[model samples]
Target: MHCYIVEYRAYAREHLDGRWPTYSRLVSLGKAIAPAGPVELWVLQSGARPGSDYTLLASKMTSTPIDAFDVLPVECPRDNVRETPPIDILITRYCSMNSKAELIALARRMVKRRPLGRLEFVGPAE
Candidate 1:
Protein backbone atom coordinates (compact mmCIF):
# COMPACT_ATOMS: atom_id res chain seq x y z
CA MET A 1 0.00 0.00 0.00
CA HIS A 2 1.09 3.56 -0.67
CA CYS A 3 0.72 6.14 2.07
CA TYR A 4 1.09 9.88 2.34
CA ILE A 5 1.39 11.71 5.64
CA VAL A 6 0.44 15.32 6.26
CA GLU A 7 0.43 17.32 9.49
CA TYR A 8 -2.62 19.21 10.68
CA ARG A 9 -3.28 21.27 13.85
CA ALA A 10 -6.90 20.84 14.86
CA TYR A 11 -6.51 22.87 18.07
CA ALA A 12 -6.30 26.09 16.15
CA ARG A 13 -10.01 26.07 15.36
CA GLU A 14 -13.09 23.96 15.45
CA HIS A 15 -13.66 21.87 12.35
CA LEU A 16 -16.85 22.78 10.53
CA ASP A 17 -19.28 19.84 10.43
CA GLY A 18 -16.42 17.47 11.39
CA ARG A 19 -14.75 17.94 8.04
CA TRP A 20 -10.99 18.53 7.93
CA PRO A 21 -10.03 21.71 6.15
CA THR A 22 -8.14 21.09 2.96
CA TYR A 23 -5.51 23.41 1.59
CA SER A 24 -4.21 24.09 -1.92
CA ARG A 25 -0.84 22.49 -1.39
CA LEU A 26 -2.36 19.40 0.14
CA VAL A 27 -4.57 18.93 -2.88
CA SER A 28 -1.61 19.25 -5.18
CA LEU A 29 0.29 16.68 -3.21
CA GLY A 30 -2.61 14.28 -3.45
CA LYS A 31 -2.73 14.69 -7.22
CA ALA A 32 0.95 13.85 -7.36
CA ILE A 33 0.46 10.67 -5.36
CA ALA A 34 -2.80 9.44 -6.85
CA PRO A 35 -1.28 8.01 -9.99
CA ALA A 36 0.42 5.17 -8.13
CA GLY A 37 -2.86 3.52 -7.05
CA PRO A 38 -5.08 3.54 -4.00
CA VAL A 39 -3.40 5.67 -1.33
CA GLU A 40 -3.94 6.14 2.38
CA LEU A 41 -3.76 9.68 3.66
CA TRP A 42 -2.72 9.81 7.28
CA VAL A 43 -3.60 13.02 9.03
CA LEU A 44 -1.14 13.50 11.86
CA GLN A 45 -1.95 16.21 14.37
CA SER A 46 0.94 18.46 15.25
CA GLY A 47 1.87 19.98 18.67
CA ALA A 48 2.24 16.73 20.60
CA ARG A 49 4.83 17.03 23.37
CA PRO A 50 8.30 16.29 22.11
CA GLY A 51 9.09 12.57 22.55
CA SER A 52 5.38 11.82 22.83
CA ASP A 53 3.58 9.78 20.21
CA TYR A 54 1.79 11.44 17.32
CA THR A 55 -1.99 11.73 17.23
CA LEU A 56 -3.71 10.28 14.19
CA LEU A 57 -6.80 12.40 13.79
CA ALA A 58 -8.17 10.90 10.59
CA SER A 59 -7.39 8.68 7.62
CA LYS A 60 -8.89 9.03 4.19
CA MET A 61 -8.44 7.59 0.72
CA THR A 62 -8.14 10.52 -1.65
CA SER A 63 -8.80 10.21 -5.40
CA THR A 64 -11.20 13.03 -6.14
CA PRO A 65 -11.16 16.72 -6.81
CA ILE A 66 -12.00 19.13 -3.99
CA ASP A 67 -14.50 21.92 -4.24
CA ALA A 68 -12.97 25.37 -4.34
CA PHE A 69 -15.06 26.60 -1.45
CA ASP A 70 -13.76 23.83 0.79
CA VAL A 71 -10.16 24.93 0.56
CA LEU A 72 -8.57 26.95 3.37
CA PRO A 73 -5.30 28.68 4.03
CA VAL A 74 -2.33 26.78 5.40
CA GLU A 75 -2.57 26.05 9.12
CA CYS A 76 0.10 27.27 11.52
CA PRO A 77 1.01 25.69 14.80
CA ARG A 78 0.04 27.41 18.05
CA ASP A 79 3.68 28.01 18.99
CA ASN A 80 4.21 29.71 15.62
CA VAL A 81 7.40 27.70 15.29
CA ARG A 82 6.57 26.69 11.73
CA GLU A 83 3.72 26.69 9.23
CA THR A 84 2.02 23.44 8.30
CA PRO A 85 1.53 22.86 4.63
CA PRO A 86 -2.10 23.22 3.57
CA ILE A 87 -3.76 19.94 2.52
CA ASP A 88 -7.17 19.79 0.87
CA ILE A 89 -7.46 16.36 -0.67
CA LEU A 90 -11.03 15.24 -1.16
CA ILE A 91 -11.84 12.05 0.71
CA THR A 92 -13.22 9.56 -1.76
CA ARG A 93 -13.17 6.70 0.72
CA TYR A 94 -12.65 6.21 4.43
CA CYS A 95 -9.97 3.81 5.59
CA SER A 96 -10.82 1.50 8.44
CA MET A 97 -7.67 0.48 10.22
CA ASN A 98 -7.46 -2.34 12.73
CA SER A 99 -5.96 -0.01 15.35
CA LYS A 100 -4.22 3.30 15.73
CA ALA A 101 -1.13 1.60 17.05
CA GLU A 102 -0.94 -0.61 14.01
CA LEU A 103 -1.16 2.36 11.70
CA ILE A 104 1.47 4.26 13.66
CA ALA A 105 3.81 1.32 13.67
CA LEU A 106 3.59 1.03 9.92
CA ALA A 107 4.17 4.76 9.59
CA ARG A 108 7.19 4.61 11.86
CA ARG A 109 8.80 1.85 9.87
CA MET A 110 8.09 3.54 6.55
CA VAL A 111 9.47 6.86 7.70
CA LYS A 112 12.47 5.60 9.60
CA ARG A 113 14.83 6.32 6.73
CA ARG A 114 13.02 9.53 5.77
CA PRO A 115 11.73 11.74 8.53
CA LEU A 116 8.18 13.04 8.23
CA GLY A 117 7.76 16.41 6.58
CA ARG A 118 4.89 18.50 5.27
CA LEU A 119 3.98 15.79 2.77
CA GLU A 120 5.82 12.47 2.86
CA PHE A 121 5.39 9.32 0.81
CA VAL A 122 5.98 5.78 2.04
CA GLY A 123 5.89 3.30 -0.79
CA PRO A 124 7.27 -0.17 -1.16
CA ALA A 125 10.93 -0.56 -0.17
CA GLU A 126 13.16 0.77 -2.88
Candidate 2:
Protein backbone atom coordinates (compact mmCIF):
# COMPACT_ATOMS: atom_id res chain seq x y z
CA MET A 1 0.00 0.00 0.00
CA HIS A 2 1.20 3.53 -0.71
CA CYS A 3 1.99 5.84 2.19
CA TYR A 4 0.10 9.11 2.54
CA ILE A 5 1.43 12.23 4.24
CA VAL A 6 -0.67 15.16 5.42
CA GLU A 7 -0.26 18.33 7.49
CA TYR A 8 -3.00 20.05 9.46
CA ARG A 9 -3.66 21.83 12.72
CA ALA A 10 -4.58 19.65 15.73
CA TYR A 11 -5.59 20.98 19.09
CA ALA A 12 -7.40 20.25 22.33
CA ARG A 13 -10.42 22.04 23.70
CA GLU A 14 -8.06 24.10 25.79
CA HIS A 15 -4.42 25.07 25.28
CA LEU A 16 -3.01 23.20 28.27
CA ASP A 17 -4.88 20.03 27.31
CA GLY A 18 -2.99 19.83 24.05
CA ARG A 19 -0.61 16.95 23.35
CA TRP A 20 2.07 16.70 20.71
CA PRO A 21 1.40 14.35 17.79
CA THR A 22 3.44 11.14 17.59
CA TYR A 23 4.41 8.27 15.26
CA SER A 24 4.94 4.53 15.61
CA ARG A 25 6.04 1.64 13.38
CA LEU A 26 3.77 -1.35 13.75
CA VAL A 27 5.56 -4.70 14.04
CA SER A 28 4.73 -7.88 12.17
CA LEU A 29 7.46 -10.50 12.44
CA GLY A 30 5.22 -12.93 10.59
CA LYS A 31 5.91 -11.00 7.42
CA ALA A 32 8.92 -12.16 5.39
CA ILE A 33 10.47 -8.71 5.59
CA ALA A 34 11.38 -7.14 8.91
CA PRO A 35 9.82 -3.81 9.81
CA ALA A 36 7.17 -4.32 7.16
CA GLY A 37 4.80 -1.94 8.87
CA PRO A 38 4.66 1.74 7.95
CA VAL A 39 6.57 4.47 9.73
CA GLU A 40 4.50 7.32 11.19
CA LEU A 41 5.74 10.80 12.05
CA TRP A 42 4.28 14.24 12.65
CA VAL A 43 5.41 17.37 10.74
CA LEU A 44 4.27 20.31 12.82
CA GLN A 45 4.17 23.91 11.61
CA SER A 46 6.48 26.53 13.04
CA GLY A 47 5.19 29.25 15.40
CA ALA A 48 1.75 27.61 15.53
CA ARG A 49 0.07 27.84 18.87
CA PRO A 50 -1.51 24.97 20.80
CA GLY A 51 -5.17 25.82 20.16
CA SER A 52 -4.87 28.62 17.62
CA ASP A 53 -2.26 28.13 14.94
CA TYR A 54 -2.35 25.20 12.56
CA THR A 55 0.88 23.28 13.21
CA LEU A 56 -0.02 19.60 13.42
CA LEU A 57 1.40 16.84 11.20
CA ALA A 58 0.24 13.28 10.41
CA SER A 59 0.90 10.28 8.11
CA LYS A 60 -0.67 6.92 7.43
CA MET A 61 -1.96 4.62 4.71
CA THR A 62 -2.93 6.11 1.34
CA SER A 63 -6.62 5.69 2.06
CA THR A 64 -8.57 8.59 3.59
CA PRO A 65 -6.75 11.57 5.09
CA ILE A 66 -7.64 10.46 8.59
CA ASP A 67 -6.14 7.06 7.79
CA ALA A 68 -2.79 8.81 7.47
CA PHE A 69 -2.85 9.81 11.11
CA ASP A 70 -2.15 8.08 14.40
CA VAL A 71 -4.56 10.08 16.49
CA LEU A 72 -4.83 10.27 20.27
CA PRO A 73 -7.55 11.78 22.36
CA VAL A 74 -7.01 15.07 24.11
CA GLU A 75 -7.34 14.67 27.84
CA CYS A 76 -9.28 17.21 29.83
CA PRO A 77 -10.70 17.89 33.28
CA ARG A 78 -14.13 16.64 34.22
CA ASP A 79 -15.69 20.01 33.65
CA ASN A 80 -14.29 20.15 30.11
CA VAL A 81 -16.35 18.14 27.61
CA ARG A 82 -14.34 15.58 25.65
CA GLU A 83 -13.95 15.93 21.93
CA THR A 84 -16.34 13.65 20.04
CA PRO A 85 -13.92 11.82 17.73
CA PRO A 86 -10.78 12.94 19.55
CA ILE A 87 -7.60 13.90 17.65
CA ASP A 88 -5.21 11.83 15.58
CA ILE A 89 -1.58 12.22 16.60
CA LEU A 90 1.66 10.52 17.49
CA ILE A 91 5.07 12.04 18.30
CA THR A 92 5.29 15.38 16.50
CA ARG A 93 8.29 17.43 15.36
CA TYR A 94 7.72 21.16 15.79
CA CYS A 95 9.36 23.88 13.68
CA SER A 96 9.74 27.52 14.62
CA MET A 97 8.87 30.19 12.03
CA ASN A 98 7.53 33.74 11.71
CA SER A 99 5.11 33.45 8.79
CA LYS A 100 2.56 31.12 7.19
CA ALA A 101 4.59 30.98 3.96
CA GLU A 102 7.50 29.42 5.79
CA LEU A 103 5.19 26.87 7.36
CA ILE A 104 3.76 25.84 3.99
CA ALA A 105 7.23 25.49 2.50
CA LEU A 106 8.37 23.21 5.28
CA ALA A 107 5.21 21.11 4.97
CA ARG A 108 5.77 20.72 1.25
CA ARG A 109 9.24 19.28 1.80
CA MET A 110 8.07 16.92 4.50
CA VAL A 111 5.45 15.24 2.28
CA LYS A 112 7.77 14.98 -0.75
CA ARG A 113 5.01 16.34 -2.95
CA ARG A 114 5.25 15.46 -6.63
CA PRO A 115 3.39 16.54 -9.74
CA LEU A 116 1.54 13.22 -9.80
CA GLY A 117 1.10 12.78 -6.05
CA ARG A 118 -0.35 16.05 -4.82
CA LEU A 119 -1.90 16.14 -1.36
CA GLU A 120 -5.64 15.59 -1.19
CA PHE A 121 -6.80 18.87 0.44
CA VAL A 122 -3.78 20.93 1.40
CA GLY A 123 -2.93 24.26 -0.23
CA PRO A 124 -0.73 24.66 -3.32
CA ALA A 125 2.97 23.96 -2.87
CA GLU A 126 4.21 26.57 -5.32
Candidate 3:
Protein backbone atom coordinates (compact mmCIF):
# COMPACT_ATOMS: atom_id res chain seq x y z
CA MET A 1 0.00 0.00 0.00
CA HIS A 2 1.25 3.54 -0.79
CA CYS A 3 0.79 6.42 1.65
CA TYR A 4 0.57 10.17 0.94
CA ILE A 5 1.30 12.91 3.49
CA VAL A 6 -0.86 16.04 3.19
CA GLU A 7 -0.36 19.36 5.00
CA TYR A 8 -3.63 20.66 6.49
CA ARG A 9 -4.54 23.89 8.24
CA ALA A 10 -8.02 24.09 9.74
CA TYR A 11 -9.73 27.44 9.91
CA ALA A 12 -13.05 29.00 10.92
CA ARG A 13 -13.86 30.60 7.52
CA GLU A 14 -13.57 29.29 3.96
CA HIS A 15 -16.99 27.60 3.91
CA LEU A 16 -15.22 24.31 4.78
CA ASP A 17 -17.60 22.37 2.59
CA GLY A 18 -15.61 22.24 -0.64
CA ARG A 19 -12.95 19.99 0.86
CA TRP A 20 -14.48 16.89 -0.63
CA PRO A 21 -14.02 18.05 -4.21
CA THR A 22 -10.50 19.23 -3.51
CA TYR A 23 -9.63 15.89 -1.94
CA SER A 24 -11.06 14.04 -4.87
CA ARG A 25 -9.00 16.14 -7.29
CA LEU A 26 -5.79 15.42 -5.43
CA VAL A 27 -6.54 11.72 -5.38
CA SER A 28 -7.17 11.84 -9.09
CA LEU A 29 -3.85 13.61 -9.58
CA GLY A 30 -2.04 10.96 -7.57
CA LYS A 31 -3.62 8.16 -9.54
CA ALA A 32 -2.53 9.80 -12.74
CA ILE A 33 1.03 10.51 -11.56
CA ALA A 34 1.77 7.47 -9.41
CA PRO A 35 1.31 3.83 -10.17
CA ALA A 36 -2.10 2.25 -9.82
CA GLY A 37 -2.00 1.44 -6.11
CA PRO A 38 -4.10 1.90 -3.01
CA VAL A 39 -3.97 5.39 -1.44
CA GLU A 40 -4.69 6.49 2.11
CA LEU A 41 -5.39 9.97 3.45
CA TRP A 42 -3.24 11.10 6.41
CA VAL A 43 -4.27 14.48 7.76
CA LEU A 44 -1.88 16.45 10.00
CA GLN A 45 -3.35 19.39 11.81
CA SER A 46 -1.54 22.71 11.41
CA GLY A 47 -0.54 22.72 15.08
CA ALA A 48 0.23 19.01 15.34
CA ARG A 49 3.61 17.58 14.45
CA PRO A 50 4.19 14.80 11.96
CA GLY A 51 4.74 11.74 14.18
CA SER A 52 1.56 12.29 16.22
CA ASP A 53 -0.80 14.32 14.02
CA TYR A 54 -2.23 11.29 12.27
CA THR A 55 -3.14 9.70 15.56
CA LEU A 56 -4.54 12.91 16.95
CA LEU A 57 -6.74 13.67 13.95
CA ALA A 58 -7.89 10.08 13.69
CA SER A 59 -8.75 10.06 17.37
CA LYS A 60 -10.75 13.27 17.15
CA MET A 61 -12.58 12.11 14.06
CA THR A 62 -13.00 8.42 14.85
CA SER A 63 -12.49 8.37 18.60
CA THR A 64 -9.64 5.91 18.11
CA PRO A 65 -5.97 6.58 18.70
CA ILE A 66 -3.48 6.18 15.90
CA ASP A 67 -1.73 3.22 17.53
CA ALA A 68 -5.03 1.46 18.01
CA PHE A 69 -5.95 2.12 14.38
CA ASP A 70 -3.15 -0.17 13.26
CA VAL A 71 -4.76 -3.28 11.86
CA LEU A 72 -1.71 -5.52 11.89
CA PRO A 73 -1.91 -5.77 15.66
CA VAL A 74 -5.70 -6.01 15.71
CA GLU A 75 -5.47 -9.29 13.82
CA CYS A 76 -8.66 -8.74 11.87
CA PRO A 77 -9.17 -11.57 9.39
CA ARG A 78 -11.01 -9.25 6.99
CA ASP A 79 -8.03 -6.95 6.65
CA ASN A 80 -7.23 -8.57 3.35
CA VAL A 81 -10.57 -7.52 1.93
CA ARG A 82 -10.50 -3.97 3.19
CA GLU A 83 -10.67 -1.35 0.46
CA THR A 84 -7.29 -0.09 -0.70
CA PRO A 85 -6.32 2.40 1.98
CA PRO A 86 -8.30 5.41 0.65
CA ILE A 87 -5.27 7.05 -0.95
CA ASP A 88 -3.75 8.68 2.13
CA ILE A 89 -4.14 12.16 0.68
CA LEU A 90 -4.00 14.92 3.28
CA ILE A 91 -6.65 17.62 2.91
CA THR A 92 -5.79 20.55 5.21
CA ARG A 93 -7.91 23.65 4.78
CA TYR A 94 -7.91 27.06 6.50
CA CYS A 95 -4.62 27.21 8.33
CA SER A 96 -4.01 30.56 9.99
CA MET A 97 -0.61 29.77 11.52
CA ASN A 98 2.59 27.99 10.57
CA SER A 99 5.15 29.39 8.14
CA LYS A 100 5.64 28.20 4.60
CA ALA A 101 9.03 26.71 5.44
CA GLU A 102 7.65 24.48 8.17
CA LEU A 103 4.89 23.26 5.90
CA ILE A 104 7.37 22.63 3.10
CA ALA A 105 9.70 20.74 5.40
CA LEU A 106 6.87 18.57 6.64
CA ALA A 107 5.78 17.97 3.07
CA ARG A 108 9.34 17.01 2.04
CA ARG A 109 9.81 14.54 4.89
CA MET A 110 7.31 12.30 3.16
CA VAL A 111 8.73 12.51 -0.33
CA LYS A 112 7.62 8.98 -1.06
CA ARG A 113 4.10 9.91 0.02
CA ARG A 114 2.31 12.44 -2.13
CA PRO A 115 2.12 16.02 -0.73
CA LEU A 116 -1.05 17.76 -1.71
CA GLY A 117 -0.66 21.52 -1.63
CA ARG A 118 -1.73 23.56 1.42
CA LEU A 119 -5.33 24.69 1.71
CA GLU A 120 -6.03 28.36 1.14
CA PHE A 121 -7.12 30.59 4.02
CA VAL A 122 -9.70 33.34 4.00
CA GLY A 123 -8.44 36.52 5.57
CA PRO A 124 -10.09 38.27 8.53
CA ALA A 125 -13.38 40.08 8.00
CA GLU A 126 -13.17 43.42 6.28
Candidate 4:
Protein backbone atom coordinates (compact mmCIF):
# COMPACT_ATOMS: atom_id res chain seq x y z
CA MET A 1 0.00 0.00 0.00
CA HIS A 2 1.07 3.61 -0.62
CA CYS A 3 0.34 6.91 1.10
CA TYR A 4 -1.29 9.79 -0.76
CA ILE A 5 -1.84 13.37 0.27
CA VAL A 6 -5.02 14.47 -1.53
CA GLU A 7 -6.74 17.81 -1.29
CA TYR A 8 -10.51 18.14 -1.33
CA ARG A 9 -11.06 19.07 -4.98
CA ALA A 10 -9.27 15.98 -6.21
CA TYR A 11 -11.23 13.72 -3.87
CA ALA A 12 -14.65 15.38 -3.88
CA ARG A 13 -16.17 13.01 -6.40
CA GLU A 14 -15.23 9.78 -4.63
CA HIS A 15 -17.18 10.84 -1.55
CA LEU A 16 -20.20 8.65 -2.22
CA ASP A 17 -22.91 8.28 0.37
CA GLY A 18 -25.60 5.78 -0.67
CA ARG A 19 -26.32 6.87 -4.22
CA TRP A 20 -25.63 4.48 -7.07
CA PRO A 21 -22.86 5.93 -9.21
CA THR A 22 -23.19 5.89 -12.97
CA TYR A 23 -20.43 4.30 -15.03
CA SER A 24 -19.35 7.65 -16.42
CA ARG A 25 -19.21 9.20 -12.97
CA LEU A 26 -17.00 6.39 -11.78
CA VAL A 27 -14.77 6.72 -14.82
CA SER A 28 -14.17 10.42 -14.33
CA LEU A 29 -13.55 10.14 -10.61
CA GLY A 30 -11.22 7.23 -11.17
CA LYS A 31 -9.19 9.30 -13.60
CA ALA A 32 -8.91 12.25 -11.23
CA ILE A 33 -7.42 10.17 -8.44
CA ALA A 34 -5.57 7.81 -10.74
CA PRO A 35 -2.75 6.62 -8.47
CA ALA A 36 -4.12 7.25 -4.99
CA GLY A 37 -6.23 4.69 -3.15
CA PRO A 38 -8.37 5.40 -0.09
CA VAL A 39 -5.56 5.18 2.43
CA GLU A 40 -6.25 8.39 4.30
CA LEU A 41 -9.26 10.63 3.78
CA TRP A 42 -8.78 13.88 5.65
CA VAL A 43 -11.97 15.83 6.13
CA LEU A 44 -10.43 18.35 8.48
CA GLN A 45 -7.01 19.93 8.64
CA SER A 46 -4.32 19.83 11.31
CA GLY A 47 -1.93 21.89 9.19
CA ALA A 48 0.61 19.26 10.10
CA ARG A 49 2.53 17.11 7.73
CA PRO A 50 0.59 14.17 6.22
CA GLY A 51 2.92 11.81 8.07
CA SER A 52 1.48 12.67 11.49
CA ASP A 53 -2.10 12.64 10.21
CA TYR A 54 -1.95 9.33 8.41
CA THR A 55 -1.15 7.43 11.61
CA LEU A 56 -4.06 8.95 13.53
CA LEU A 57 -6.59 8.29 10.77
CA ALA A 58 -5.44 4.73 10.31
CA SER A 59 -6.00 4.18 14.02
CA LYS A 60 -9.75 4.53 13.48
CA MET A 61 -9.76 1.08 11.95
CA THR A 62 -8.60 -0.50 15.23
CA SER A 63 -12.12 0.00 16.51
CA THR A 64 -14.74 -1.67 14.36
CA PRO A 65 -17.28 0.55 12.59
CA ILE A 66 -20.18 -1.34 14.22
CA ASP A 67 -18.89 -1.21 17.75
CA ALA A 68 -21.46 -0.40 20.49
CA PHE A 69 -24.26 -0.62 17.96
CA ASP A 70 -27.43 -2.59 18.75
CA VAL A 71 -27.57 -4.26 15.37
CA LEU A 72 -27.30 -7.99 15.17
CA PRO A 73 -24.65 -9.61 12.97
CA VAL A 74 -25.92 -12.10 10.44
CA GLU A 75 -24.13 -14.64 8.34
CA CYS A 76 -25.03 -15.22 4.71
CA PRO A 77 -25.14 -18.63 3.13
CA ARG A 78 -24.32 -19.11 -0.51
CA ASP A 79 -27.41 -21.24 -1.18
CA ASN A 80 -29.70 -18.63 0.30
CA VAL A 81 -30.46 -15.38 -1.44
CA ARG A 82 -28.26 -12.54 -0.30
CA GLU A 83 -30.23 -9.65 1.11
CA THR A 84 -29.46 -6.00 0.58
CA PRO A 85 -30.57 -2.83 2.24
CA PRO A 86 -33.26 -0.88 0.44
CA ILE A 87 -32.21 2.33 -1.24
CA ASP A 88 -34.36 4.38 1.13
CA ILE A 89 -33.19 2.76 4.32
CA LEU A 90 -32.16 5.32 6.92
CA ILE A 91 -28.94 4.20 8.55
CA THR A 92 -26.82 6.32 10.85
CA ARG A 93 -23.27 6.97 9.70
CA TYR A 94 -20.31 9.04 10.78
CA CYS A 95 -18.73 11.85 8.79
CA SER A 96 -15.21 13.01 9.23
CA MET A 97 -14.93 15.57 12.03
CA ASN A 98 -15.32 19.32 11.36
CA SER A 99 -15.37 18.48 7.68
CA LYS A 100 -17.41 21.35 6.29
CA ALA A 101 -15.52 24.17 7.95
CA GLU A 102 -12.18 22.56 7.25
CA LEU A 103 -12.99 21.94 3.61
CA ILE A 104 -14.01 25.56 3.17
CA ALA A 105 -10.80 26.76 4.76
CA LEU A 106 -8.84 24.31 2.67
CA ALA A 107 -10.30 25.76 -0.51
CA ARG A 108 -9.14 29.21 0.50
CA ARG A 109 -5.70 27.97 1.42
CA MET A 110 -5.40 26.04 -1.80
CA VAL A 111 -6.13 29.15 -3.84
CA LYS A 112 -3.08 30.79 -2.34
CA ARG A 113 -0.83 27.75 -1.89
CA ARG A 114 -1.96 25.45 -4.69
CA PRO A 115 -1.67 22.92 -1.87
CA LEU A 116 -4.67 21.10 -3.24
CA GLY A 117 -2.99 20.78 -6.59
CA ARG A 118 -0.10 18.84 -5.13
CA LEU A 119 -0.46 15.05 -5.03
CA GLU A 120 2.32 13.14 -3.31
CA PHE A 121 2.82 9.39 -3.65
CA VAL A 122 5.25 8.07 -1.05
CA GLY A 123 6.30 4.44 -0.83
CA PRO A 124 9.09 2.00 -1.75
CA ALA A 125 10.59 3.45 -4.89
CA GLU A 126 10.55 1.44 -8.10
Clashes of each: 4, 11, 8, 0
Query: On residues 21-125, what C-alpha lDDT tens digit does candidate 3 reach at each position?
Result: 211112111111112233232333322333232221111123343232111111212322234344458433322214444433333334334333333234432
| Pairs in clash, predicted candidate 4 | none
Error of 2 at 111 (Å): 1.1
Ranking by lDDT: 2, 1, 3, 4
Q: What is the Cα-based TM-score of model 1?
A: 0.21
Candidate 4 structure quality by residue, lDDT tens digits, 4-114: 323333245456444442211100011111122222222223234432221111111223431211111122223333344655875433223234444333323322321
| Ten contiguous residues minimizing lDDT sum, candidate 1 | 24-33
Candidates' C-alpha lDDT: 0.32, 0.34, 0.28, 0.26
lDDT of 2 by residue, 29-58 (tens): 111111223434343223334543333343
Q: Model 3 Cα displacement at 23 (Å)? A: 12
Residue 10 error, candidate 4, Å: 13
Q: Give the winner by lDDT.
A: 2
Instruction: Score every model by TM-score.
Output: 0.21, 0.24, 0.17, 0.17
Span of 10 residues, lowest total lDDT, candidate 4: 25-34
Model 3 Cα shift for residue 68 (angstroms): 33
In model 1, the Cα lDDT at residue 100 comes to 49
lDDT, model 3, position 88: 57
Most TM-score-accurate candidate: 2
User: What's model 3's lDDT at 83?
Assistant: 40
